[model samples]
Target: MGSNRTNFRVIGLFLLLISMLLFAGGCNNKNNVLSAKQLTDNTPLTVKVLDVGQGDAILIRGGGQVILIDTGDVPDRDKLVSFLKSEKITTIDKLIITHPHADHLGGFAALVGQFAIKQIIDSGQITTTALFRQYLTAAQKKQIAFTVASEGDQFDLGSGILLRVLAPGKPLLTGTDSDLNNNSIVLRLTFGKFSMLFAGDAEQVEETQILKKYSREMKSTVLKVGHHGSRTSSSLPFLAAVAPEAAVISVGLNNDYHHPHPSILKRYEKQKTTVFRTDLHGTVTIAINGENYTIMREKGENAK
Candidate 1:
């Protein structure tokens, strides 16, 4: 009877160990891509076009990740910080500087100190401004990972969302009127049936290159208008190739540059693409769930 009892105890111990092992294996599968049925109303991707006034700043949140693209001009320093705090964004997974222009990169110094930024993706373009130098120094001091994004790099944002680099391709442009603006890092983000193209202030030269090589790939559900809708960018052919259903322009209101040029607005109208401007519309938020999306503007109505 004593031997039989001991045998039963050993079998119980073995079964307990098996149960523990199975539990651990399930926990380890966290990184697996979400299946279709799993993409219910639980997790939705949110993209916010912050009203930085005369610059670009886009916040993308989904899959438990936060991505920031560009930091508006220097004057937006405090406002940007406040916005982040309001959103409860403590850490930034990725910070992408489309270019070194002041309007696009001015808030970098403040951001480095404000949040725990893990990685920085640059457009591989150089500028000799004081702010640019300070920005680089801060990143170096923090020892954050930095990547000079090339044309074909892809970033997995988990949960079936992907960000693919589409510009700053081989043999970078030269002899252009503004080399810096032309080489801005362009990105295309895809989540299920929805896609958005970020055209970081890219002008005609850059737009021409993209349409020439990847016109077919330019199609997107949303397009962040290039160069704040300046006449210098957003060529008709380029816009036609993109054929976006919606366009968002990040620009200031009645300040120095009269952006979202009238001609450009006409072009978008011709394309039958609804337009949203951060200057007029305090902040534009686009929430996406699978193939459907909802747009909420904090300020003005859709551009007329």
Candidate 2:
């Protein structure tokens, strides 16, 4: 854990250099541009898409930071905390809440009592949910730094691991059917040649907005499928733009919403992109070493 904090300042400085380099070409946001002296290449990066039952709970470890994208639903909060303990994760450096939805932000309060949370980043979409208030209070009590995800804003998650925010910028959308869903935090995390795009329940509206703003920068190695594979997301154009070699869908078995729609599966197949579903595959894990990467599942064999 100490080594993880060692590169925080160096990475921050490197990120500033990257920002300045990208300033002239604002949209050319390269996910991985760390110099050899900066990256801890010997320490492989791993991303775990935990099986949280109908919700998103992604754990990204390596480069000295333990980052959690979204917690599972409230009912599964204990499972989440127990899993972290089992992994020996005593602290979470970054806990990013994609939106204010119950499923996405549910386990926040639980982790507050269980772990040392260093900082929190959320969509900042105001909602009158008790769970939301609970997380706010927890952050306040703990005095953890809180940030609202913004388009083009990037954070260095220690040791040259870059978390680039791609959507939910200023002038938030309004009068939408699900303003929350459309304004969810969309993040592109990068380490060396590996990159995973975490689209937090972002629907077609948000997808379209990202495509328009970051078409060239959207290509990634893996994509965390948006809206639990709802028909409202993964628009063909958007898919074409990102062109992730593999896609992971976090959905529960026999879920009420019937997520990871059959049509979306067909689209993934059409694009020759292998799809992994938490309901069918259990926990899906991706390990990255330099330019090589492998995806494994808890219930099934390893995927290419």
Candidate 3:
């Protein structure tokens, strides 16, 4: 009788352990399945240019799709992910790698693992970095849709918001010292009569090329200052061509680059352009409705 009781107790314990394991596995599976479903569900469109300091990460939402342009540096990945979660963005509809530079694409690998990415738009080819290689490998393994975006490529971002690619036009010049920055993807976003230009670190060389191609149509309401306001970028001729009413520069506070170069700021001042910067004021958001728009700083301070 004693032996039979002991055997029964052991069987009960084993059954309990198996039951607990099954329960835990089921929960994990359910959570993953739910997360996958969330990726496909449509969400309202909104654009947020996160303040990752000296790095760029623009979030565009519309038509139930969330598009992220650049992912900032590697150290800021957790902050970027948290910000997205706070905004209830469970998936990234499109991820645009404006360029291969570390500041632009460093956080990409971390993000790819955390979110469901539907498609990726890059300038075509990799520039050979550990991070870049990791991004490429993950992209391949996940079978994420990839495209080499260039001039004239247009896509909708829900509710009449349209993004048009406007740079890195044909031939894809390589082997030049300025190739990386010059090849940055420039995007023009149009919503009704309000439009903004996001030139991803495109310096004078690329700007001159862009002007030659789209001189008449470069005017915009908001300009995301290129190259972190580097003297090599945002040239006077380019500024005149863009003629943006307001400009935002994403740069780190007291950065080594000494961005928002004095000359560039003076030019903007001369043009009477309203300038806002991330290093000083934090995240800057511009919202457009028809032909009108409003600029809001994270700290609720008036942008200079």
Candidate 4:
């Protein structure tokens, strides 16, 4: 009887050890599954066009670099910051002011205060408006590396991603009658066979200038519709020149500017290009890999 009791105790102890091992193995398996999911979800390149409503703010992530183009107006600063945080961006490699327009540069002051800015690029034309002056002051105090980007200037951010300046061949005279919208900085970004054009509030005059200077069609896979799709921009000739598969217009809903004019919308339809609008869809993100591109809207579904 003593031998039997001792054997029974040993068996119970073995069973407990097996149960503990099973529990630990189950936990480890669960952890491994979660890690695999996370690895699959992370994207290599992401372009997020934040919705500031009637303003422009686009974030580009590629080749281990982050580039921010135009912060929206003042009221949208918090939202922009939140979006950056959500994306796990700790510093800005490049900050580009497309133009001196209030809507484009209004949030720069706040952004400079919030994050580490490595460099800044602008048209380098000072403005008389207080908001514009504030942006200049903040940039100066931060001692952010500054440069005036001209047509043809190119830089590589990583993974074969290239940003090429495409507008404002020369600085415009300050306080001149020439429309600021026409002087807006245009950028063309290319990754492999996919490319996108960001025309910052540029109007017909600027488009005409680009056409004359380049003497080539502005072909891109995606086109950020100019002047928020106003009738003043996105000329039919320019549209034909680009021949993009997709177009995005960043504008406000019910804005007084009457942006995304019906005429412009009809023109895009005529070309059979898919159109996305921030005014109606909120933030729009475009992800490109090699020759493939995918678009995701904040309010709508993703399209590839």
Candidate 5:
């Protein structure tokens, strides 16, 4: 009788262990797969790379949050405000000014009162430009929380989406033609299996630094071409490290500086990267659903 009881107890314990393993397996499977309905739900992460001529302005909306990256040039102030209004964006949860460049943050002062801004993020680097000071003064007057971004800083945009800073390391880099450009806030946003890198005017030095520190994390689905696809920004090593499937260059049509140098275009073509330019494709929008994403353009042929 005693032996029989011991045998029964052992068998029951074994069954319990098997049941636990099966339950864990089921949970893993559920997490690994998503139904078509879930993937095609009404809400999906949307990133709008606004066509602010010769400047950078990207609007990201997801998980009940809205983030504005840059404000573009002074002339784009009305355009940016109108676009935000059209989207029914009453408040900006996070406003990231990559740098103080006129074409990047020039419209910031004018936009200070446009939206109910929660926080303002800037690269710690300082400049004496009048535009920069104006932006700073406006932020102060508004009493918006200011944050200086650093490498490894992460901003949670909910729904498992995270924006991580990869550049402007501590102590600030120097010796570059434009330290502000090189120190631009480099951010990488990841949503499930999808990822996009916003390389804010980062040049070779900044790229090399980031590569040395975060080589594994550099690969992304989309890349915002640095410095409007300037030869000085996207070096061969940088391109190899990023390995972006798609590239977007925010440049004006037929403006001075002859932006998006032909050689740079050739480099992207060699990599077989689908290149889209703001000049060519106005306001490129990428709607992300789980690991899948759809790229839409406002206008023009998809090109260099």
Candidate 6:
């Protein structure tokens, strides 16, 4: 009789363990992408468009969390690490890789060596470069929770800041000149009355599709000019839909590609949008407290 009672107790505990496992899984599947559980303290939302010349490396801080989107190029990895260290950022709550391009994913090696990245959100686009292979291997070695962002995926970055993936849905953009760049992950970060559109090198091809789908929802206070303001991006329709009060172009000062192309610059000028370039501004900082916001350049005149 004692033996039977012992068996019964074991069965009950097994059931309880299973129940806990199921509950935990359900919670994890809720968002499925990013993770930030801390509540807000009503502090200002700040995004530093780091001047990682010729590439993108944005530092988003808010809701008691530090998130990095894109990590410049191979040549700029050490610079990125130094800048983050200066800001006292050691643990990255989330690291977002817009796509697997050399200029975007090259800094992963440096980041992995320095920061304790809790989670990683990627575009899931494959590339056949040595750098790309190393990127995947490193992620596996780090054992970080990796997620492939899809359209309509919404992640709460605490403090009521909501980031919505707006592009790179199923059957990723193909048959393009540069499918990698065209299918780059496009994210719209919304917080209170301020919003910013981040299209990681998404050229006109992808822009057309996104504009058609999220046109009504694309209006933002700031637009991170696509493809570093190359002529291939910043389509007229896209610019009109976003209609941002300020636009930031992340590019090198004397890049061979001649980024922030004269033609694209004219478009921003025609729209009467205030332009901020990391090359000239040093590091562009955008601060938002509830409904009011300000754009302060690190060196150039602080903008509104």
Q: Write the per-residue lDDT of candidate 3 for residues 144-230, one digit (tens) a residue.
A: 999999888998886888898888988775665579888899998888777889999898888988999899999987899998889
Q: What are the Cα lDDT values of the candidates?
A: 0.88, 0.87, 0.82, 0.82, 0.88, 0.87
The regions of model 5 sitting more than 4 angstroms off are: 1-41
Q: Which pairs of residues collide in model 5?
A: none
Instruction: List model 6 lDDT by residue over 1-304, tens digit each.
Output: 9999999999999999999998888666521211222213344688889898899999989888898989999999999999999989889998999998878887999999989999999998998899999988998998999999989998898889988999887779899988999888999999887899998999999999898889999999899889999999999999999998889988888998999899899899898888999988988877777566667777876222
Candidate 1 lDDT tens digits, 172-204? 788999999999999999998888999999999
Clashing pairs in 6: none
Q: Model 1 off-target regions past 4 Å? A: 1-43
Put down candidate 2 lDDT per residue, 1-304, tens digits, no spaces. Answer: 7877878978999999988887756434232323334444354688999999989999998778899999989998998998899889999999999998999999888899889999899898888989988888889999999988799899887676888999996888777779999999999989887888999999999998899899999999899999999999999999998898889999998999988789998999999888988988998877776565767778964232
The number of clashing residue pairs in each candidate reads 0, 1, 4, 0, 0, 0
Per-residue CA lDDT of model 5 for 197-291, tens digit only, reads 99999999999999999999999989999999888888998899889888889998886978898999999999988898999899998778766
Model 4 regions lying over 4 Å from their true place: 1-42, 171-178, 215-217, 301-304
Worst 10 residues of 5 by lDDT: 30-39
lDDT of 4 by residue, 10-38 (tens): 99999999999988886565212222233
| Winner on lDDT (4 vs 6) | 6
Instruction: Tell me the TM-score of each prediction against the true structure.
Output: 0.86, 0.84, 0.83, 0.83, 0.86, 0.84
